[model samples]
Target: MKKKTFVLVVIALVSVGFSAMGQRVDRTNFKAGIHGGVPFGDISDHSNFELGLDVGYHIALSELIDTGLTTGFMNAFINNDSVDAGPVTVEGDFPNIQYVPVAAVFRLYPTYDFKLGADVGYAVGINDGNTGGGYLRPIIGVNVSGNTELNISYVKVSDDYDFSMAALGILFLF
Candidate 1:
């Protein structure tokens, strides 16, 4: 089910990009960044901090709107010395909970220097399958300098166990 949804999203985004190919537009932007944040909810019970990397491509849809594709890797570092599974208790350290998020991104730029955006997509787990979920992230951004942007975002991932994070990051645009 998750794989099907992911394929559909990729197809839709690709179609949109192709349809926009003939339009004369401002400019497209490519951005990459790193972010760090604290985990909340069920995740907080086991994790202390989260770190991630993101890359995105945004094309101007209008003076005020932009649509794009974004994908990234996020990991929540574990805190417990051991984990209990059913009647069995496993000792020693475990690997961080990791996710790979692939999403459609939309941005509303009220001004050239300020923007609000959201990323809606699926996050796939990399280990132990503890974090695979659907994710929504709302972000606020400011252009601190030419081609440099600073952003703060709240990310919510919904699954069997829901979790959230508050992230601050800087992106370099090209």
Candidate 2:
């Protein structure tokens, strides 16, 4: 009975020690950002620039790696003249195309100021008759200030039609 009690206590102590070691009070726990850029490929024919905003919470998985959940809103301004249906045609400027992206983000920090990351998940469309699709964004970032980071990324969305964009953004960590 005493031997069993000692083993249980030892296991508890080791678990507590490891948990304590994982605690760091100096790291930023949350981040938010805004970005703008131009769309390419087939989307460019209908839209011009794209704008977006994102927020996330991150946990350090290791000294050089972090993983998190992120979500954002992005919109592309439409510039088409008219649309044709089976027998009817509508002639007017339309609403902007919007997407809400929810993704898992993995970041690899090679240095205190430089990082590379990828976001993979799905983007939901916010327009009528538009279906959502899977998305992939690969990014490179540089910490320009203590709490501010600048990043450039390529975003791709795979739906009935594929679209892509190149974006530059700034993130504020807290």
TM for every model, in the order presented, reads 0.84, 0.79
**Model 1: how large is the Cα RMSD against the reference?**
2.8
TM-score of 2: 0.79
Which parts of model 1 have CA positions greater than 4 angstroms off? 1-25, 83-92
Worst 10 residues of 1 by lDDT: 17-26
Q: Backbone clashes in each candidate structure, one number apiece?
A: 0, 0
What are the per-residue Cα lDDT tens digits for candidate 1 across 25-133? 5778899999998888877877879999989988888889888788989988888888765699889868888888888888999999999999887778788757577
For candidate 2, what is the lDDT? 0.79
Question: Per-residue lDDT of 24-121 in model 2, one digit per residue for the tens?
Answer: 53453589999997999878877889999988766676788776667889998887776554498888867777889877777899998999998877
* Segments of candidate 2 deviating more than 4 angstroms: 1-28, 83-90
The numbered model that scores best in TM-score is 1
Listing every candidate in turn, what is its Cα RMSD in Å to the true structure after a full C-alpha superposition? 2.8, 11.6
Candidate 2 local Cα displacement, residue 135, angstroms: 1.0
